[model samples]
Target: MTTDTASPIPSDAEQFGKPLQGWRLRLYTIIFEADTRAGKLFDVVLIAAILLSVAVVMLDSVEALHQRHGRWFDVLEWCFTLLFTIEYIARLVCVRRPWRYARSFFGVIDLLAILPAYLAALVPELHLLMDVRILRLLRIFRVFKLTEYAIEYRLLSRALANSRRKILIFLSFVLMVVLVLGTLMYVVEGPEHGYANIPTSVYWAITTLTTVGFGDITPQTNAGRFIASLMMLLGWGTLAVPTGIVTAEMTSMRRRPVTTRTCHACLTEDQAADANYCRHCGAKLSPYQYDREEEQPVRR
Candidate 1:
């Protein structure tokens, strides 16, 4: 007798190894088929994992975490890196057409997150040159981005995505203005009053623009104070632009219509007979639903 093993290649396996049932036809439409409560919960677990990854990155940068328990922290970092590396490898093994995914953006990220740790071990000095363990902070965003699969979240995401270019352009200009003003202030205000250098002045400008108001550094001269006033005014409107963009997107997302495509198991649409699920989302199609001859509507 042959013992059954989990398929290294994931084929029709429901989300997170949970069985797909109850309109799996529709459930399978998602990259991660998660229509059940358990599946949904598992999805949350993945999100947490991504957040943990970012926490690890931030924690690694802490001097205390490094100084107090260097060995323990090293062990923890290695463990997390190993687990993520193995998971990345597993994804490659299980995903159909792994090469296709490998070439894609997320595939590269999966590789990037773990590659640095391994590189750190293999090469002597190259590790220092390319310790991308810090880049894992980006992974946190990907975890939150999973909300796009949800109809509501996707709508909100679309709004933000649509305005991304414009927002970036606006931010670039803001940064340029900050730099120019910061340099001017650095020259105008002498070194004794915290505007000692161009970089320091720029840092203060950034803090002021973001409305952080970190008073650790302050300007003492008239010219410096004038620049600070302008920065404060710029901060008020500049900071709100991104927030407004995101808020507007969220508002528009709510007004859009919901679409649940034909389920592979449930024949809900009429087509040219060659249709497999709706062209929209791979819902199984039937000719009778739209046909005039089949007029009776029955309870599903």
Candidate 2:
């Protein structure tokens, strides 16, 4: 009798190795997918660390506090820096396309977040560069829970993109107005009245136009004062125009279809209700069903 002696097929874990299927994949999911429980927990922990690091930086800026707890602050800074370094490395390793993650906006932010500590560690003389660590406050963006409002960000981005030309034109007009007012103020006030030069007058005009009165240079003449008053009034009204434009665009955007199924691959949550693929990354939105009973295993 002829015996069929066939070896068993390898599972997905055995076939592709551990990198794509086991704990590595689980780590990727926790790190990258916000919808999952593990992922949410990971984000919570990350946010807490970010907040503590930011608070440490803020406290270090206070001279009294720095004097008393300088050593503790330094230790905490290094700890937070090390934690972020590990996270950054893990993120780079877990993603299938490390280059893509490295080039992304969050990736750049993450690098900036940890750079100061390393810079300080390598070159103690470069302690001045530690001020760049203030940029870590941008981590508040991740903490504000704004990531959950994908639609608002998308709508606002679209509105801003659409309004860019109009906003540019408005800014150009404002600049021309500033130049004319500055020249007039320089001619009227001259050096004695605190208008030292055309540039200084222009600076005063800008400050008045923006309603940011510094009080270091003020128009002593009736004409200059009148112009300042007019500019202040104009500034108040000018601020409303940009707001109205964005509001109109947002209203128009409300008509578009929206969905809550965030793509685990690219974090693109602004898909349509019926979308089967992510609009941003083209990743599968819905899970695929497999009929394991009818499928034949591959012979090894």
Candidate 1, residues 143-255, lDDT tens digits: the string is 44346335455555566666676678888998898899888888888688878898988988899999899898887878778888888998999888888877775565444
Could you say which candidate leads in lDDT?
Answer: 2
Which residue ranges in model 1 land beyond 4 Å of their true spot? 1-31, 35-97, 103-105, 108-157, 260-262, 266-300
Q: List the residue pairs that clash in candidate 1.
A: 262-283, 277-283, 277-284, 278-283
Q: Which residue window of length 10 is worst by lDDT in model 2?
A: 4-13
Candidate 1 global CA lDDT score = 0.60
**Global fold similarity of model 2 (TM-score):** 0.67
lDDT scores in order: 0.60, 0.70
lDDT (C-alpha) at residue 9 in model 1: 21
Q: What TM value does model 1 have?
A: 0.53
